[model samples]
Target chain A: MSENTTYREAVKRAIHKAMKEDERVFLMGEDVGRYGGSYAVSMGFLEEFGSERIIDTPLCESGFTGAGIGAAVNGMRPIVEIMTINFSFLALDQIINSASKLLYMSGGQFNVPIVIRMATGGGNQLGAQHSHSLEGWYAHVPGLKVLTPATVQDAYDMVGLALDHPDPILIFENSNLYNTKGELDTNATPLPIGKAKIHREGKDLTLLTYGVNLLKALKAHERLAKEGIDVEVIDLRSLRPLDDEAIMASVKKTHRVMIVDEGWKSGSISAEIMARINEQAFYELDAPMVRVCSAEVPFPYAEHLERAAMPQVDEIVAMAHKVMEES
Target chain B: MSEFIMPSLGADMESAVLMEWKIKEGDKVKKGDIIAEVETSKGVIEIEIFEDGIVEKLLVEPETECKVGTPLAIIHSVSERINISPAAKKRAKELGVDLEKLASQTKGTINLSQVEATDEKTETKAPTTDGMRQAIARAMSKSNTEIPHYYLSTSINMTAALKWLEELNSQRPIGERILPAALLIHAIVLALKKVPQLNGFWQNDTQEIISEINPGIAIALRKGGLITPAILNTQEMNLNETMHSLDDLITRTRTGKLKGGEMTQQTITITNLGDLGIESVFGVIYPPQVAIVGIGNIMDVPWAENDMLCARKVVKVTLAGDHRATDGRIGAQFLDKLDKILQKPEELL
Candidate 1:
């Protein structure tokens, strides 16, 4: 069965289903109980699951995140929400050093089965403080798995997959995608984590993207198709433990790549993907890899400046054309 | 007993200042040992002793300027000599092996095998020469500006020559065997006799077909530069004689023992880059000379003979002829004659 839903509603339905099925699963974060959620994802969940399951916390990121890790290690599956990715820096020590390492540090005696979710990306004009996509930083950590859900189906699926994983996992939900509506197939086969999905296939160039940029790349591909420049669109659903087989297959077919990422250009996820392509499929490439990424600057407060800093649909189209012209 | 004179270090050098004596009177010195330093226009160069001797007298004083052949020192030859077999000595001369350098490397009497090993070890390219680097740069720049060269090439099937060489080497001793380069040089001289149009110079606004066939052989120095010294009067020699002269020329070129006339008397040049694994080489004419012949790597290639396809060893030969000295027809005829000569390898001997 399929139903029309926004990314926020699909995510809320997935969390509600996990709460109904597992008794050990609980939700905890600041203002998660009485105020519903910062984005109203869990409205009225405090009354339905009661205060025991929908627990609230004080305004301390590190303390609450560490407590969630401790509870996860003991035998409970806790879903910890860190409001925005920019504020997650306050709990960096617990996320990378503590939660990410506890399984191996304890000699495999204890596993921190916790899922940390945060709103990422910079299209909402939340100013420099609240709008930052720092998922690539967490992807750099070895022991952690990172997932960026771009579609409503993935938003419903990846959250349940992360909760079932034995180690720590971080889900970056782009704030701009919260209200974007799409059809969600509830009975579709679940996709395994760390596998990329191809939205459209072509012979000219491979367009690799994730998060909100996936939609922008799809739009760019439609425009390029009209101009007779066929482009293959691939959504890298998971960042860490990247699907190298999928990437190499597309690269060998098209012999050209254009990575569109919302993160900044330097040391960003696009750089990592480009490096992997060079290492594994360098001889298959006909031209150098191209990328359209966010400008290396703090997110601006003004709407026009913010739009200019992030990658747009027109830029992705232009970069794809550039790759075709080079080949 | 011999007098060590001021050696001509380069074609352009005529005089240098005696900088300092590293050894005094009565000091015993072996071969390849540096005994003095001279200040040339290039830089301070350390001069090595060519013989094992005891210094009898220092003829030139420090800071005194001297011409190219002026006596710099006098030494008495040592009786305790490094012995080498007569066969090995003959082989070394033909191979142009530096016996003094070979003597410094071994303790016992040297044999033919040891001399061959030394020749094989010195084939690789090494570091650089500061002055030779600048000289090459200036000459190449001049050649690029003045010479309008026309290049032509052809592939020679070497099935007959290689088979003949293998059969000939099987019957002879190791010391008497001739290399493929020697055979190629012999054929080139014979071909030049037929097409005298290429064996000459472009001077005084006309082509000068010199009677003497002094073909310059481009030898790359171990210290990272190149020098082309001619094997004078190849038209008067046979295959074995040409091979011996080539070896002696190479040895003297490396040891700084070249005569002044060999540097400026080249009528035509030949560069064999086959040992470096190059597939084809089109060399630039080293000015004054009208043409340069280049030989590339020989490898097995497919051939069609009498409507049958088979593999035959083949090599690519190229000629870079100055447009003013010769036309394409003459260059093509020369290559055709060279191919015919190589086919009858027995006639070359």
Candidate 2:
């Protein structure tokens, strides 16, 4: 219980715990069983559950994803691992067209208890193909629950919550954060999907973000704190069915908002958040909403190019300072 | 004959550039006519004639910077004879005594020495970099110094109002969709129509309120700063028309392309914070206007009805008024009427 573990280990332990506690739960995806998952988040699970339970699927994302959906509909809890969000596009037919729609399109006949885990966001120079933060894209799709666990506690608990959800769930883990380690309270209960956590409370401005950007926002928050700017960092762990109540509550106290997202600028989650703030908290705003998003370009192979393409700590800090000055 | 003293033009400035003249010596003038354009730190502002008469003498020429309170021109009435003061005549002579030549060359009193002095000062002083910032500072300073403000806050249930908006939006195109801000603006305009007393200027000297419903909607610009652009004659406009006007004003404001009449002549203001999630905010009453309405965020809260608690969408509205012009009773009555109008949003339409 007191052993040092990586973020990847924390997630694997949570999955193992949930699967062991419930016999209905099983794992399925390419390399998830025999290969112990592409990121090793399911290492040693195949021996414990066997090939039937720990399903090693073909490279067909749509096919295997469809299988996961079918299994979930038939009263089996299925966790589908997509190697990376970059590969999820192949499975969009099953995820978006099938999994996301089953609950609503069926008029509530079928509840798709499917958890689709994907490593998202560009950081390790995975080139344009492998690296992408597609959480916003998934969040935009209705009937799909999107969860991004930035901390160990969240990573340990979100899997349980996603399993409990009677709908399709997309959980994004940053490839760069796999080695990040933090303490986890084993007895911690599962968190509600739509609730945002204020990791650091400050009065100057509210930094609203989720996923990998949450870490970037926290870094920016630390830098700003040194400069005497009290930035309130809100980690929107769940993207869809957004916790506007939590966001607005913080906004009411802070009076300024700066959204941080790793997605491209236009039509991103930041735009939606800004619009909601404008529609809901217009009077409380002393300044207009600011967003720090990834550069609207394809990810490049060069380390410097990729770093520039993604939203950085400096950019977030600058945005926070700008909002602070406005307030 | 009466001499027109140079207007202060603005605070902080002791002198203003006499940029141009609309009239010359011997020209007949009427009160309220644009007599000249004076350049200050703010902008080139038109100076209006105060009295109806014939221009017998002009004391300040184009390009001349004259001190405030210095005589700029002499307007002679039909019953009064023009008398040139000996001191002014001597001063004019010492500065090169060619009255006819000066009038012919400049069409006004050519204060050459004053112009030379101002030119020397301009070269020595650093030019102001931010004109809008300077104007805002001056305006804010003046308002804070001159106005006596009092704030009153009330919570309004927007449950019925939002539902009405949803119903209205369902029937409209995406472009014509009714938003909460639009509905609030409409409600505020209608409320002003009912409480016309709040929509006016307070003449502090006489302690009288002059009513006009020119509603200023505070627009937050994308680049920086807040500006309250006025929507003239709010009382006469329908909900759709007001919404359309507000949309146009905000579009212009965000683009930094506001027309001349958009910022000035506001009789009252509405600062909406509903989008930013603030429950209620107390706003400082902009000077001249007796009151300003601050709209807060809409949220679900428990409300008591028949001794039972029920969830309802409530918005906090604060009305900041000049106590000299309005009493608490009048403010309370206005808010009550505003709440009623907002609750029954269909009445505004």
Q: TM-score of predicted model 1?
A: 0.50
Question: What's the TM-score, to 2 decimals, of chain B in model 1?
Answer: 0.63
- Report model 2's TM-score to 2 decimal places: 0.52
TM-score of each: 0.50, 0.52
DockQ of each: 0.00, 0.00
Question: Compared with the true structure, what per-residue lDDT tens digits does model 2 show for residues A21-98?
Answer: 999899999899888999999999999888888999988998999999999999999999989999999999999899
lDDT of 1 by residue, B267-297 (tens): 9999999999998899999888899999988
**A110, model 2: CA deviation in Å?**
1.7
Candidate 2 regions exceeding 4 Å error are A1-4, B1-349
Q: Alpha-carbon error at A83 in model 1, in Å?
A: 0.2
Interface RMSD after interface superposition, each candidate? 27.2, 24.9
